[model samples]
Target: MLIYLLKRLLMTILVIAVTSVIAFLLVHLSGDPAAAMAGEGASPADIASVRETFGFDRPIVFQYLEWVGRILSGELGRSYYLRMDVSDILADHLPVTATLGVMALSFALLLSIPLGVAAALRPNTVIDRVALWLAVAGQALPSFLFALGLMYLFGVYLRVLPISGGTTWAHFIMPSVALGYYATPAIMRLTRSGMMDVLQSDHVRTARAYGLSSWRVVIRHGLRHAIVPVVSLAAVQLGFMLGGSIIIESIFSLKGIGYLAWESIQRADIEVIQAILLVIATAYAVLTLLADLLNAALDPRIRIS
Candidate 1:
């Protein structure tokens, strides 16, 4: 198990390294940081001054290496566009997105698990059909459009929830619902399938033959093995939530990392953009490794493999 964990950690580090390199190069090459920082209708001298101030005139490789070294040493550097510390900016906004993600994930699991279990328990029944329709609709609808409809129904007309600005718990409801429902389809389908397969396994039959009650066999024995794949898929879905939060955050005006990314893109803030990309990429790598570790812990076969 230790060996497997170490290997996974190494792979995660390598992936993050490659991602950082690509993000650095892409951000630098995408647009003129100097011009963006200088604002519209800036003179050539103003642009040159801005470039000089931000070290834009330096070789790209040198700048990238320097930035990487600083990042490794726990420095996010100052934002050229915002004229503030990049780390400070992220610190202020990261929690909002992080909280939203956690809430959304929780909502998804709460809804999907029961629906999936029900569908698996009574396949081809009304409950199963309802679950199938939900899964299909959740996947087919765009999150933003879904969010707008929710906002109108719940926020505008019903006045039960806030339409935007994730300040209070009420404000968080719609965004979390919109984001969480987007992930629900995949989870529900996978869970139902996993449960069905687990139930048909020899172990399940043996447990049933041993006089174990149906509920006990299904809950204690069946769900244990069935949840393994669900766990892995959930981790990936979480990464998607983090990445997809950009649109949701914008619609809701939440001061989260996703909203920060949107702002940085509009202004072409290279420093902020690069830092955000690196942060998100590292999160993806770490979460995937965590999923692998969790799977190995739950099922020893994974570690051996």
Candidate 2:
């Protein structure tokens, strides 16, 4: 287990390093950062001065190295537009996004699991067909469209929940449901398939033959084993949640990292952009690693494979 963890950790670091390099090159290649910082109507001399001050005057390799050193030293650099430390900006906003992501996933599980289990238990029945149709619709609809529909029904018409804002629990309901519903179809399908497979297994039959109640046999002997894949998918879905937050946050006025990243891009704030890319990529790598570790822990054969 220790060796497996170490290997995963090393792989995570390598992936981050490679991502950093690619992000750095792409940012530089996009256009002149200093020119973007200077804004419209700035003279060429002003842009040159800005470039020199920001070290864009140096070779790209040296600039990347310096940026990496600052990261290692915990200096995330300043946002040219915000006039604030990049770290400070992230500190203020990441929690909102993280909370939204977790809440969204939780809402997704709360929805998909029961529906999935019901579908599996009564395959070819009305409940199963309804669940399948819902899954199909969820996968077919875009998240933004779903969010708009949710806002109209729940917030605009029903007035049961707030459409936007992250101030309270009520504020969270609509956005989480909208953002999470996009991933629900995949989760529901996985759970349904896994449950069906487990239900057909010998242990389940043995439990049934022993006169265990249908619910008990399904929940104890079937769902428990089926839940392992769900756990793994949850980690991957977290990455999806974070990445998808950019659009969702925009719709809901969520002042989170996703919105921050969008703001940084409009301003061509390379410092903030670089920081965001690294942080998000690192997050992806870490989540993937955690999923791998969890799978290995749950079933040791994962490590062997």
Candidate 3:
């Protein structure tokens, strides 16, 4: 187990390293950060001064090495547009995005797992069809559109929930639902398929023949085995939610990392954009590693594989 964990950790570190390089290069490739930082009306001298002050005139390799070194030294650089520490900006907004991601993932799992179990248990019945229809609709519907509908129904029409802001739990409900629903169909279908396969196994039949209660057999034995894949899927989905919350955050005025990314892009805040990309990529790699560890723990066979 320790060896497996070490291997996964190494892989994650490599992924983050690669992602950092890509993030840095991509931002640089977009345009001259120094030029962008200088106002359009500024003369060439101003751009050169900005470039020299920021070390942008240095070799790209040296700049990348210095950036990585600073990152290792717990510095994320200063934001060109905001005139604030990049790390401070992220710290202010990361919690909101993390909270939203957790809420969204929890909502997705809570809703999808039950529906998947029900659909699997009663395949081809009305219950199953309804669940399938819901899965389809979830996949087909755009999250922004769903967010709008939710805002109208709950915020505008019913006036029960707040339309925007991350100040309260109530404010996150619509955004969470809308962001999470898109992931529901994939999780639900995986659960349904996994459960169906598990149910058809000889162990399940033996458990049934042993006269165990149906629910107990299903939950204890069936779900325990079937949920291995779902755990992995949930981790990936959570990472995605964290990275992809820009649209939902924009719609609902939630000040999260995603919103910060949007703001940085508009202003060409290269440092912030690069930091955000690296952070998100690191998050994704870490989540995948956690999922692998969890799956290994749940099924020892995973450790061998």
Candidate 4:
């Protein structure tokens, strides 16, 4: 187990290193950061001064090494637009993003699990068909469009929810629903399939033969077994949620890292961009690791192997 963990940790480190290099290079390749910051009307000397200040004058390799070194030394650099430390900006924004992610995940789980289990319990029935159709619709619709529709129906037409901005729990309802609804299909499908398989298992058959209550057989025996796969799906979805937040946050005008990243990109704020990507990659890597650990814990065969 220790060796497996160490191996995964090493792999995660390598992935982060590779991701950092790719992110840095991609941003640089898109345009000269210094030139972008200096603007079009700037004179030659102005460009040169800006380049020197930002160390864009250095060789790419040296620039990367310097950036990495500064990162190691706890300097994420200042945003070109905000003229403030990227770390400070991230510190302020992370809580909002985290809170939003947690709420959205909660909403997704609450919406998916019961519906999926019910579908599995009575396959080919009206309830199951309706759930499946809803799942299909969720999978088909894009999150931004879904959000807009919700805004129109709940916010504009009914005036029951705010269309944009985060001020209260009501403000979170639309965007969280948008994000959660988009993710529900995957969870629902995974749970339904897993539950069906678990229901047909020998253990479940034995439990039924032993006169266990239907709900007990389903919850105690089948639900427990189904959870492993559901958890794996949940972890993957959680990581995706972090990445997908950019669109939802932008649509809702939420004060989160995703919003910050979007604003940073508009101003060519490389520091914030790099910081956001690095943080998000790290989060994904960690979530994967946690999922592996959970899998091992749930299935002893994994630990044995």
Q: Which residue pairs collide, candidate 3?
A: none
lDDT by residue for model 3 (43-77), tens? 99999999999899999999999999999999999
| lDDT of the structure predicted as candidate 2 | 0.89
Question: Residue 85, candidate 3: how far off, in angstroms?
Answer: 0.9
Off by over 4 Å in 1: none
Q: lDDT for each of the candidates?
A: 0.89, 0.89, 0.93, 0.86
Ranking by TM-score: 3, 1, 2, 4
lDDT minimum window of 10 residues, candidate 2: 296-305
Q: lDDT of model 4 at residue 191?
A: 86
Return whichever of 1 and 2 wins on TM-score: 1
- For every model in order, what is the number of clashing pairs? 0, 0, 0, 0
Q: Which candidate is the best by TM-score?
A: 3
**Model 3: lDDT to the true structure:** 0.93
- Candidate 2 residue lDDT tens string, 1-305: 77888988999999999999999998999998889988999999999999998889999999999999999999999987889999999998888889889899999999999999999988999999999999999999998999999999998999988888888877878888888898898899999999999999999999999999988998988987888889879888988787658889989988988998888889899999999899888888999888787778666576776
Query: Ten-residue segment with the worst summed lDDT in candidate 4?
Result: 95-104
- Predicted structure 4: clash tally: 0
List where candidate 4 sits over 4 angstroms from the true fold: none
RMSD of model 2 against the true structure: 2.0
Off by over 4 Å in 3: none
Per-residue error (Å), model 4, residue 66: 1.9
The worst-scoring run of ten residues by lDDT in candidate 3 lies at 296-305
lDDT of 4 at 13: 89
Pairs clashing within candidate 2: none
